[model samples]
Structure formats: structure tokens, C-alpha cells
Target chain A: MDAAVTAAFDLRSWSAAHLDRVESALSRWVVAEAPAGLGDAMRYAVLDGGKRLRPLLVLAGAEAVGGNVQAALRAACAVELIHAYSLVHDDMPCMDNDVLRRGKPTVHVQFGQARALLAGDALQALAFELLAPDDEGIPAGVQARLVRLLARAAGHEGMAGGQAIDLASVGLALTEDQLRHMHRLKTGALLQGSVLMGAACGSADAQAQDALRRYGAAVGLAFQVVDDILDVIADSATLGKTAGKDAQQDKPTYVSLLGLDRSRAYAGELLAQALDALAASGLRDTRALDALARMVVDRDN
Target chain B: MDAAVTAAFDLRSWSAAHLDRVESALSRWVVAEAPAGLGDAMRYAVLDGGKRLRPLLVLAGAEAVGGNVQAALRAACAVELIHAYSLVHDDMPCMDNDVLRRGKPTVHVQFGQARALLAGDALQALAFELLAPDDEGIPAGVQARLVRLLARAAGHEGMAGGQAIDLASVGLALTEDQLRHMHRLKTGALLQGSVLMGAACGSADAQAQDALRRYGAAVGLAFQVVDDILDVIADSATLGKTAGKDAQQDKPTYVSLLGLDRSRAYAGELLAQALDALAASGLRDTRALDALARMVVDRDN
Candidate 1:
């Protein structure tokens, strides 16, 4: 396709095909084997739900770099598993205590807390397991790089660390900078890691890597901004989660800090920044990445 | 040292030296960097406690194969971190609900459930992070191998799976095979993974690998059998945690399956099996492995 045609490419169809592939891969990977309840809870947590945005970012990142399809698929699934596991753990009574997610009962609510906890723990390990399979198709160097990136993003320095901050910040007012720092570790790190993991599947020049990193950061933050806005404006039915949870919990959010109108504008600005980074990447096939940035900024949920 | 001297080596001194190295490495790795409370909980969960048997197993296995010291140290700390994380989670109110561990207040009891949960999650990620560092000292192949081994041992097919089975089997009668299967996955897997991870740090022939696997499996099961015996015989203070928890929870155990005398006899048999595997390994410097087997079988706590 030419530039104009690629620019006008049907993202819905593209995403649909990718989502189907991811769903099938996830179903195959998340099995209900010997330990009956744990496997079932894991499958319940992972399969048949959500946007699969992290996986999409992974695939887009890989596509941008002309990366291997098989490796990219594995990376995509791995990131989604991490994201899913995080959600399972976060929804527990000790944390968010939410009863709903993805328009359905949360894992902790559907399967009791103990099973939910084990399911999350198992999913996290499964993510790394998928990334570093005993297959010769994936190079050892690639496996090591993927594991290192994912681990850091999911560990104390990243998502989990950010979560600790979120927990401590409950019912407390926070400055914009502190909120941004918290969001960067909490949600931004894994999203950035997804993009880098996709890049790791293929080779990228330093210039391209820098651009993708910037693009990932902007998109990651933009997603969160949009999320906070939706939490305020959209109902629980539309958002597929408990609406206005941040305000209810007295937790700080971008919408709370910048106001809804400004947060929406900020998301748009981040979208522009993400697109600019893509342009600077100097790669020819970043249509999916560009479309994804638009989707993140535009989505209601 | 000469063969006779090596055969008659003082195991206590040798273990003490290795324990010192493992403890120092763990202290260096388990840092309380960011997210304030999360790091504290992680440090609290990992530091200043436990027998460090898993780390010792890793060191001994590495030593048996002349593995790289740095790689072995990393593996040792990584395995212990995984173990510590499991303990933190297991002690949570949702699971075992114990108030004390290592003779101190459990993580959730001291830091609250949220911090404890995040700490456990972070520790798990930290374990993988330690295994696959962004360094050239450890080869990519070795990192991939170590990660794959550890993940499988800790995931659905291993420790987590065993825990699920344990949870479901509470208040239910289990056959000998069923009980063994549970222990194999729960405790045996990580123990065996430690041995395999150590072997991964060095070069081992196929025959040697088989022997080590047998040795690991035997020792792993032996450790659990002894644990069951100790749970019945030892008091709460002596065990450093709640004693008689298995029976209290109505959980099936080796002691319940094969009375005390038979359980003790089974542990002795397992120790002999482990030693025989070590002998079959044809590795000259297995003094440490032999002594460890004895310790596992003989230890009251």
C-alpha cells in the first residue's frame, strides 16, 4: 500500500485479526491442567476479555522494526499476561477491592481470593516462561533481553513499585510531578517495556530505538490520561470497570490534577508527541503504531 | 585437599563459609530502593532469616560442577528470593494466615496486606531480574536456561500447582501417590530447579545431569518428609513458625500417610537415595552434597 492508503488503513480490521491470533495463542497457552482450580482461574483471568492493547503495542513495535512474527507473538502474549496478572492482584480486597472488571466479576471475586492470588502469581511466571521457551526458533540472546526488560518493568522498580506508591497515596493529595512519577512507574513502565520487547524481537538502530522509547513513553502516559478522563465521564457499563474509583478512593489522577478538559487536551498532546516520535523513527511501516496511538487517545474506555 | 582429607572434611565450617557468601550476596541483591514500604517489606521478607538451605543447595550443586562463582551466587540469591516471596504470600491472611515467620511478625501482619502482597510480587520479579542481568559475565544461553528452569519450577506445573493441590486437598484423604505428587510439585520442583540452575552455570555431561536430577528429586522429597516429621514433633518456637499447622489445617502430610516411624524411615530412605545418586554422579567433590542430605534428614527444625 502507498503512503496515503496505508495512512487510511482500517485499524479495526487489523486489530481484529491480531486480536484473534492473540486470543487463540492465549487459549492454547493458558491451560487447565493437573492442578484443577489454579489453571481454571488462570484461564478465567486471561482468556476472553479486554482490549489486548499491550499485545497490540508489542506487535506494532515489532512490525515497525520488521521483527519476526513468531517472536513478536510470544512477546505480545507475555506482556498481556503480565497486565492481566496485575489486574487480578490489584482487584483484591486489600487493594482496589473492586467487584467488577471488563464488565464481569473480577478474578478475586469470581474465584475466591486465594485462587485469584495463585492465578496471578502463576500468570506472571507463565509470562516469563513464554518469553524464554525451550524452542530453538527464539534466540537465547533475544530471550534474555526480553526477560530482563519484562522483569524490570513488572518488578519493584516499575509496576509493583508504582502500586506501592498508589497504595500509600490513597486519601492523600499529590502534586502533579509526584503523580506523574507514580504513573510512570505504575502504568508507563510495562507499556514502554512492551514496545522495547517488540523492538528486541528484531534489530533496531540506536536512532530508531530512541524514537520508539519516546513514542512508547508518550503513548503510555496518554493511555493513562484517557483512562482517568473516562473514569470521570463514562459510566461503569461503558468503562467496564467501576467508574470514578480514583475519586471514591481519594486517589490522585491526571483528570483530578489537570481537570477533565485539560486531561483530554494533554492526551491529545501526548498523541501528537507519540506520532512525532514515530515520524522521527525513520521507519517506513509504523502505520499500526500510529493507529494505536490514535486509538489510545480516542478510546472512551 | 587430598582425597582422604576431602572425604573427612568438616561440613559445618564449609557450610558456614558458603552461607556467609550466600547471605552477603542476598543482602546486596535484595535492596530497599523505591516505593518506600514495598522495599522494606521485601527486605524484611528476605533478610536475616531462614536456613538458607535453597541457596546452599544451589551453591553445592554449582560447586559439584565447578560452576562460575558469580553465576552460582546470583542463582543462589535468586532461588532464595523466590522462596522468600512464596513464604510472604503463604503467610498472608488469604492463605496460611500465620502471624509469625522466622520468629518475627509475618509481612502482612507487620506491613499490612497491600504492602505484603506487593512485596511478594516484587520479590518474584526481582528473582528473575537477578537471574537475567544486563551483563556479559553471564552468557545469554545460561540466562535463558536458568530463567526457563526457575519459571517452570515456580509456575503452575510446580510450586504454585502444588499449593493449589494442597489447598483443594485440605480435609480430604489422599493416597500415597497423591501426596507424593503434591510434594513433588510444591517443594520438590524448586529444590530440583536449584540443582538444575547450578548445573546450568557449569558444563555437565548428560549422565551427570541425570544423576543430579535424581539426587535433587530425592533430596527434595526427603526435605518435605522431614518437614512433616518436624511439624509433628517440634514446637512452635523450635520451628520458628507455627508448628502442627498441617494437622491444624486438616492438610494431608507424609506423617499422616505413613505414621511417624514410617515417615522417619522414608526420610532416611530418601537420604540414602540422594547419596546414591551423588555417588553415581561420579563427581569427586560431592562432600558438601552428602552432608546436605544428612542435614536435611537429620534437622529437627
Candidate 2:
């Protein structure tokens, strides 16, 4: 096969292969220290569902930087665990009060609300546990960096902070900038963090790191824009959860602020920005990232 | 002063001084990243209240181990954050449904269930964030170990695991062993983790670490036993919250299972065990740890 032919990335196969690794690791690690039936709740929340996008972003970032494979794997799972926990808590009666997620009952619905809350809390701790592996597969420096990156993204300044803003923003008119800021913290930080954690797993030049940051930012925003679009146009079945939840809840979103067509167009623009930043990275290969970026924009759900 | 005379450690002075340091650090770090009023809820939950036992345990353990001061400070704050978050969640309507904590309205009562949930989640992340400081005040190895100890103690098979069992055993008649197991995970794990994290901050040989572990376990279980005893004998004013609430809920407790006198004796016995472990550690100075163990057994609240 020609170099150009080999260079062409097939995201389906890539995703399939990586998802298997993530699924297996999640299964093994999620139960490593769970007591009694709590492991069952955690496994239910983590395994056999979701797109596993964050883990893929982590792996792709690691590949771009030729990062440590063990650290990359752990970071990948850690991010997904964070994402899963957020979703679990968000679906609780006290939060979003949702019943469906990833075409199944939300954690709170499957397990009781209290169990769900405990599961979410345990999952958050389990994430850092994964990063700080006892066997020392990765260096301690990388472990600290991974924990720092993850904690920042998941904590008050990042996802939780964004959710706070979002929760308070309900029924209120939020400007494009404000909405962007909210999403930047809520979703963007972790997405960017996944990339940075991957980079931290190994060596990445300052310039390359900057490029990856921009790529992650663009891809992250593109994801939200696409999500907003899907919430408006895609059916509940296709979206895997109730469609139009934001509109139903009167939450401000890209579609709510910019209309569906503009949101779709904006997602494309962001996708272009992501690819441009990836190109600036000057890595040996970033086709996986590019394909992911495009997929984020073009996916119907 | 003679060495023997100085060896008579005063816990009151030690706690007062360390509490000032812990409180100030917590105030600075808790708000460092909070968005909107989420920080307000977090600060409210963390500051100006509670016994601050966990932080004291960490500091004392560090002092005994001659550990890195900076890392010890961070670990102290991190473990407390986990403890605070757990309380916030535990007091929510979906869990224990308590309306009071430390004589104030529960977090969910004051901030609403949704914000309370987010605040607790943020605090947990903040715990990890504190451990993984960007300035590198602590070595990466120490940081990893600190995170591992805290995460293991806070996650399943630890605090959350114990809570799950406690939640499930609401009306059940649990044996003494079963009740001990529950409290060990629910409350003992983080308490024990405080000591281990402190030890991890610098240097402790296997023998010393083992001794510290034993001391932590004894103090941890002693704390719960004292708590149960207090719930039976102390008033809401003295206990800083409702008393006799355990019997009200019919949940298994040391007092409920073992009777008040035996439970009190058990706490005293555990305190003795903790002191014995310190003696076995063979460290030059373990007076602070000794003081803390005594405090855990004897504190009115």
C-alpha cells in the first residue's frame, strides 16, 4: 500500500478497536475495589454504553504525541469515568431528573437515587485511583500531571462549574458569549483536558501542545454545537435520549440562541478550525484526530 | 525545658495552631476555582464549622513521620474536602435526609438539592486538585501515593462502600462484625487515609507505615464508637447536631449493637490500641498523633 493510502484513517475501525480496549479496561478497573454490590452499580454506570468519545480523544492525543501507552490507557479510562459520573449525577432527581441515557435507564433509575449518588462519588474517586495506579505502570510525574489535568477539568472551574452556571441559567436569556463560556467550562475543559492529559503522558513540544489545545477547544465546541443541533432536529430514538431536552427545560443552547441551521453551520466551522489546528501540530500522524473532528460535526446523533 | 517534661504534648495547643493553618489554606484553595456561587456553597460547607478531626489526623501523622510539610498541608486539606463532600451528600434528602449538620442547615437545605449535589461533586474534585498541585510543592511519587491513599479511602470499599451498607441496613439487625465493617468503610477509611496520606508525604519505613496504619485504624473506629456513644448520651447542643438520631432511624451503631457501656469501653480500648501503635512506630516524636488519638476518643462532639 502506498504511504498516502496507509495515511488515510478509517475512524470506524479505529473506534471499534479502541472502544474494545476501553470497555475491557473499564470493566476490570471499575470493579478493582468496589465493595459488595456497589461495584454492580458502578459497572452499570460505566460499562456497555455511551460513545466513549472522551477516551478516544485521549487515545488519539496520546498517539499524536507518541505518549506512554499505559498512562494513556489509564487517562483514557479516567476521563470516561468522569464523564460517566457527571451523567449519572446529572440524571438524578435533584439535577436533570432524567430517566433515559445511552438508550438505557439512567443510573439513578437503574440503581436507587442514593446508590446512584454514591456510585457517582465513587466513580470520581476511582478516576484518580486509576491515574495513581499502585503497580506504577506510569511514572509518578505523569501520574501527578494526569491527576492535576483531570481534577481541574472535572472540578469547580471546569465541568461542575459549568453545570452550576447551566443550572442557574435555566429560563434566563443567556448571550452567545455567556453560553459559549458556560459550555467552555462544562464540556470544553474536559475535552481539552483529555488532549492535554494524553500529551502529559509523554513528550510534546510547547508548540505542539499549544496546537493540540486549540484543536481540543475547537473539537469540544463543535461537539456542543452538534449536540444542540441534534437536540433540535434529531428524534429521541436517534439521539438515544429525549430530544429537545434543552428546549423543553428552556435551557439556552446554540440552537436556542442561533437557530438549528446556524448551529449546524457553526459546528462545521469549528470542525474546520479543529483540523487546521491539528495540521499546525506538525505530528507524524493526526488522521485519527481529524477523522474524529469530522465525525463530531457530521454525526446525526 | 527537659526533654521528658517537653514530651508531655498538649493537644489543645497543637490543635488550635494546626486548625488555623488548615482553615486558612482551605479558605484560599476552596474558592480558587469556584464559578458563580458554587464556591459559596463549597466554602459554606467546608469553613467555619465541624470538628476538623480529619485535618488534625493528617497533620499529626505527618509530624510523627517527619514528612514533607507542604505535602502534608495539601493532604490535610484534600482529605477534609473528601470528608466534607461526603457529609454534604450524606445529608441530602436522597440519603440520610437530615436537615441539620454541625448545628447549621444541611447543604441541600441551604443551597437546594441540585446545588448541593454539584458542590459536593466539586469538592471531591477539589480534593484531588489540591493533592496534585501545579507548583510541585510535593514530589510526584509522594503526590501519586497521597492521591492513591485518599482515593482508595474515599471510594468503594471505603467511605462510599460503608455508606451504601449503612443506607441498606436501615432497619436490619446487624451483628457487631457487620456494623464494624460498615463504619470502617463509611467513616474509618478516610480517617485512616488521613494518616496514610500524611505518611506518604515524605518517608516512613514499612514498619513505621504499618504502625501508622494500625494507629489510624484504631483511631478511625474509635471516632465512630465515640460518635455512637455521644448520640446516646449527649444532647444536640453538645454534639453540635441532633442526638439519639441513630436510634430514631433504627440504624445499627456501636451503641445500638453493643450497648452504651460496652461501646464506651470499646472506644477506650481502641484509643489504647492507637497509643500502643504509636509506641511501636519507634519514631522520635509521636506526641501529636498520640494526642489526636486521645482526642478522637474523647472529643465531646
Q: Estimated TM-score per prediction?
A: 0.98, 0.98
In the predicted model 1, the residue pairs found to clash are: none
lDDT of 2 by residue, A1-301 (tens): 2376356678999999988899999998988456656888999999998888899999999988889998999999999999999999999988899999989999888889999999999999999999998795689999999999999999999999999999999999999999999999999999999989988988999888999999999998888988888888889899889898998999999988998788878988898899889878877678788888888888888
Local distance difference test scores for all models: 0.90, 0.90
List each model's interface RMSD: 0.9, 0.9
lDDT of 2 at A142: 93
Alpha-carbon shift of residue B253 in model 2 (angstroms): 0.9
